[model samples]
Target: MGWLDGYVALVTGGASGIGRAVVKRFIAEGCTGVGVMVRSAEQAQGLQDEFGDKVLTLMGDVRSPADNQAAVEATVARFGKLDTLVGNAGVWDFFAKLEKMPIEKVAESFDEIFGVNVKGYVLAAHAAAPNLRASGGSMIFTLSNSAFYAGGGGPLYVASKHAGVGLIKQLAYEFAPEVRVNGVAPGGTVTPLRGPVSLGKQGKSLSAIPGFEENVANVTPLRFIAQPEDHAGHYVLLASKENSCATTAAIIQSDGGWEIRPLR
Candidate 1:
């Protein structure tokens, strides 16, 4: 039997990148049904076309409480029960530095980033809490190695991820024995999470960190960039009752050992 054979799952940002991979992986695991909440109608349609009846696609922004609630409700309506909520929607402001960035600009960064990453997770969890409790299910968040290390993002993005770490602990405490809460910190999956990174005040691109190919070959010990599928098993494992009991508040660092690289 598939790991999620009898369960229903909701994945936010499920149209592309890691979110897309998670959706694809869960379906392969024989989930009873999969619902993907994305912001773009075009993207949602593509997913619907690809998966046909086995998947449900909703077009909505994670920043809206109504949207979050609607996605949860729809998942239950479609599959009859909701067992897992994967808060995988996140944003990164890579094109600017904190000091040189204007206050308004920084605030915009905060709103865009936290709106999806933090508030979205909380609202989705709140909406799904009842159904998850009924199924004795779990919540899994997609975090980044930035949560632990500095320089992974601009100050604002890094701070937001750190907040995610706290959210994991606090929610785990709040959810208790009936529902489990955890996070997976990925080092660098070759997704579009990064963009024209800014230097100090010049809006310079931070592309010097290393190209995707180089990051895999020169930085990661595994000597390869991770595809989204590389991180999918952790989600299945965390969602499984047998494998994840007593595992609340835990963070599985699925990163490629970048945390230990000696400063050169």
Candidate 2:
């Protein structure tokens, strides 16, 4: 029996990067079904090709309330109950400094970055709350070391992730004693995390940055960059009642010891 035996889950941004890894891992852990919210038909087709009926891929934008709700309803409908909600969709600001942008650009970038990273999570939580409460399930969000430290991204991206910390705390409080809410903060991982369109970086991916992996490895205390799979287990643990019971409003830092970075 796997950790998530017979479980059902809904994951946003489940097409690629850390989000995709979580969907794959959840199924490997014996999830009965995983509802994936993706933005493109290609993503939906790719998931179907890989996981087949094990996953139900829904094409939609994470910033949409109806899409989030549809994903939740679809998961419970297919698997009979919802056990986990993984709010993993997000956008980065590519380290776009605040002072460099005009005030108007800043506003647009903030909306785009926060729309995907912050508001998306909020909508997913709202949609999944009832189901999670009914099944005594948990909510796991994909945060970043940026949520705490700096230099992970630009002002918009970093600030958006920081907002997630508070979101988790508030939601955990609202759903206490019945459902748990938590987060996984990953360091520089080699995934195709996208940038905000507001900055004309929508076509660019995080991993495509020149020497990104090497740079991340050199700076990180662990001397290595992470892969999406490295953080997937944290989500599994948070989703498992046996492992993380009584744990709520907590964030597990999986960023290669980010708290002790800079090598003193």
**Number of the top-ranking candidate, with lDDT as the measure:** 2
Candidate 2 — which pairs collide? 95-154
Give all candidates' CA lDDT scores. Answer: 0.82, 0.92
Model 1 over residues 30-96: C-alpha lDDT tens digits? 8878889987779888898888877898888888999989999998998899989999987776734
- Tally clashes: model 1: 2
My TM-score estimates for the predictions, one after another, are: 0.91, 0.98
Clash number for every model?
A: 2, 1
| Candidate 2 deviant stretches above 4 angstroms | none
Q: How many clashes in candidate 2? A: 1
